[model samples]
Target: MAGYEYVSPEQLAGFDKYKYSAVDTNPLSLYIMHPFWNTIVKVFPTWLAPNLITFSGFLLVVFNFLLMAYFDPDFYASAPGHKHVPDWVWIVVGILNFIAYTLDGVDGKQARRTNSSTPLGELFDHGLDSWSCVYFVVTVYSIFGRGSTGVSVFVLYLLLWVVLFSFILSHWEKYNTGILFLPWGYDISQVTISFVYIVTAVVGVEAWYEPFLFNFLYRDLFTTMIIAWILWSPSDILEIHPRVFYFMVGTAFANITCQLIVCQMSSTRCPTLNWLLVPLFLVVLAVNSGIASSIENGLLYTLAAAFTVAHVHYGVRVVKQLSNHFQIYPFSLKKPNSD
Candidate 1:
């Protein structure tokens, strides 16, 4: 984490001239989430670092993912003849997810409240969020990928890519347009996923196996809700470690978004395609090339691991570079040197 400089001298200079720019026209974010965040931000003391709040929210989502992974590693927990995840886990997930979402909504306000807003905070927040887009979605898929009404893991895999695309698209929009038009779907997706989690807790996973209308199972309803958010806004290969595939995709997108954030802060043009995606594309191709399942699984794991290491290394270096450039600690509220 220390003595690393992945960001180039040119990029460091870019950071010197960086200025944060963004726009949020999202109705939910503007009208609902902002007001809610305004109230919630008051709960924290001024000394609290916004990055801490952002990181805490991210950990909650990670905890939810771990919980689901332990209980339903195969996404078949509710399939007949398999053990169902305890109802209480779902209840806990629901509450924790809402809390995480709330923290995400308010972290920026906390930054402004303390008068400590910095490019590092924005990078840290959005970078964690890029990964979070995967974790929470994978956690929620447990609800739809259970029992007789289960959506195919393949479908869910594709859905995860869509989620990543949405995330990167918003950042990419900022890259090109110079203002992030916060996607309308983001708020809707979070609220809907949390609601589904609680409902699953109340009615039990089996209740979701029943059809809702004209043979459209609750699983379809769930996936459709995700799709609906896309059409109005003009928006995987499951089996043998679906989440690894998701991790690969998520990291690829995260790198893209993080780079975009750098460019956004530095007022530079972001590349249209990231070199990281080249390896990701090759891995995806090899995995789907009818290769042996053992080999496919191995490839997924290797790619996921590679992407994670690279993304984290890049993130650390970028943060360090920004901290040096700005003369402020990454996750601290300490004042810069006055001498």
Candidate 2:
């Protein structure tokens, strides 16, 4: 009686959703705490299929771990507003994304291998993935960089457009549409998250190597990610907006190709380790600065730009490929189905 606040019957009905705070969750070891990870896991019976919930919870754990690791340094403005998602929340989210996607395997294999796949289950799984991807993306902006406002103003548009457009055009060919439905759309979402992890790691390194390198790198690399999404829009919209779709795709692709080339070339040079070049770059920047001629004398702007570009681009491709290979979903709610 010392402190009970009245909760209306309506509020009480929804308590299950918030009852998730009952358990203490760990960043690294989530599988051990099955119920802890799966907010709704408590409801499922031992006999009933628990693969989906288990996987989904694991996905959140993955994201949570990553975000905690990466975004903790900056203490961005967005962390406080996400309710339970604090600054360390990014890592939790990363792990969460990771787990949910990994479970995609159990969901499918159990169905195909165990002969348990159902249309309703498939639909629910996919729907979960789509929503999860959106959640993680939004969380990325919320925890770091400029957080929510920046996402609202810029990030969301590109993400939503690509996703929605893809959803639309995927139906043009039923077979192709089926492909788009991979783990219920988590395929693309996972790809995006993997890319972000790679890029962010590079950015972190840049911040350590030289403060402003990330700022420059962010400009170019961020453009690549956003452009890729925008360019993909045309492919998604061909059915609903054919002519316009082609125009958008054609134009965006050209720009995107240019970007990819520039980025890829720089990326190629990033890890090559040119110790001799560092001093040479510095001399050039020193000579070039003050006057236009002093460009590369002190290894100033040009060298910095070169370093940043390499880190960003290589990360974009290599990490993305690796994620795909491993089936780690960064952007989508899709879980792993391997093994």
Candidate 3:
């Protein structure tokens, strides 16, 4: 469908009636982070696009991922015979992460400060966040390393899904309630991750390899904290390659989250289960139920490609619609001409 429109005429009309409603009950957000963001946002010139700030922050996190991949491709940095990541890398990552977190907090405020707030800005911000969930978690996993020296990749995969789901659920909540109740876990996770990065810089990754108590290493504590807060299956359904499996899960989650954002922004009713999930669910059932064991991996890879293309296309269309409806450039601060 060359002319597929992700947002309908009704939804486009609803966008005109869209109102941004959100509640931040976390004292950390309200009392601390919000106040700090207010002060920091003043430093940004009004000419800067909030979307620019959002995109820059996202790039920094991606850069961190690249750095980790270069140093610890297998997540075995601390294991014997593996090259250890430098102390400076952790320090650099820590500093960059804090800055990204700050920019994220300040972007919306910057939009409000400059009187350039638009539904598109919120969409842009949250949409990027849906992907950032993967980057930040994967980079953090590099710190602890994978395998016997740290958490397993399979466990990390599961943790990453927990995070992605939490993110999707938050937006889903907004879809139903018409109010985004900002989850308390977000601030806590960001702060803790930043702190861990800095700590690793100071004490070195070796420190984490040691046990905190009762033969339980710091990795155990780290994993426990995440479980208190929020993998991969060997089942026939999960017969696909690990990397392909990760992409499939991540893409599916991103698609669902972006769709929910569309619903929230347009003030429309979100489907209880997005139509995209139907194939994903069926793949799971067919493989595990022994109906498609022989071609399970092929099905997974196909699903991965489909989900990724569908999500990217949906995002582009929705952005195009919103930009046209509002008469604003997606990433530019320039005023639209009346001509």
Best by lDDT: 3
**Using Cα atoms with residue i matched to residue i, what is each candidate's TM-score against the true structure?**
0.83, 0.34, 0.81
Model 2 CA lDDT for position 239: 27
Q: Which pairs clash in the backbone of model 3?
A: 158-231
Q: Per-residue lDDT for 1-339 in model 1, tens only?
A: 467676667776776665677777778788888898899899898888899899999999999999999999878886778888898999899989999999999998898898888878888999999889888878877886644668765567666767776787777777777677778888888887788788998887767663322222223322343233222221023455566656666676677778877777676666666667566555544444444433655666787788789888898888877888888887788867854
True-structure RMSD, every candidate: 6.9, 22.2, 6.1
In model 2, the runs with Cα more than 4 Å from the true position are: 1-51, 54-87, 147-152, 171-339
Model 3, TM vs. native = 0.81
lDDT of 1 at 48: 89
Candidate 2 least-lDDT 10 residues: 208-217
| Candidate 1, lDDT over the whole model | 0.74
Better of 1 and 2 by lDDT: 1
State which candidate has the highest TM-score: 1
| lDDT on C-alpha atoms for all candidate structures | 0.74, 0.36, 0.76
Q: How many backbone clashes does candidate 3 have?
A: 1
Residue by residue across 172-270, what tens digits does model 3's lDDT show? 888888889899999988888888898998887767663221122223222332222122222423222444555566666677788779888787777
Order of candidates by lDDT, top first? 3, 1, 2
**What is the alpha-carbon lDDT for the whole of candidate 3?**
0.76
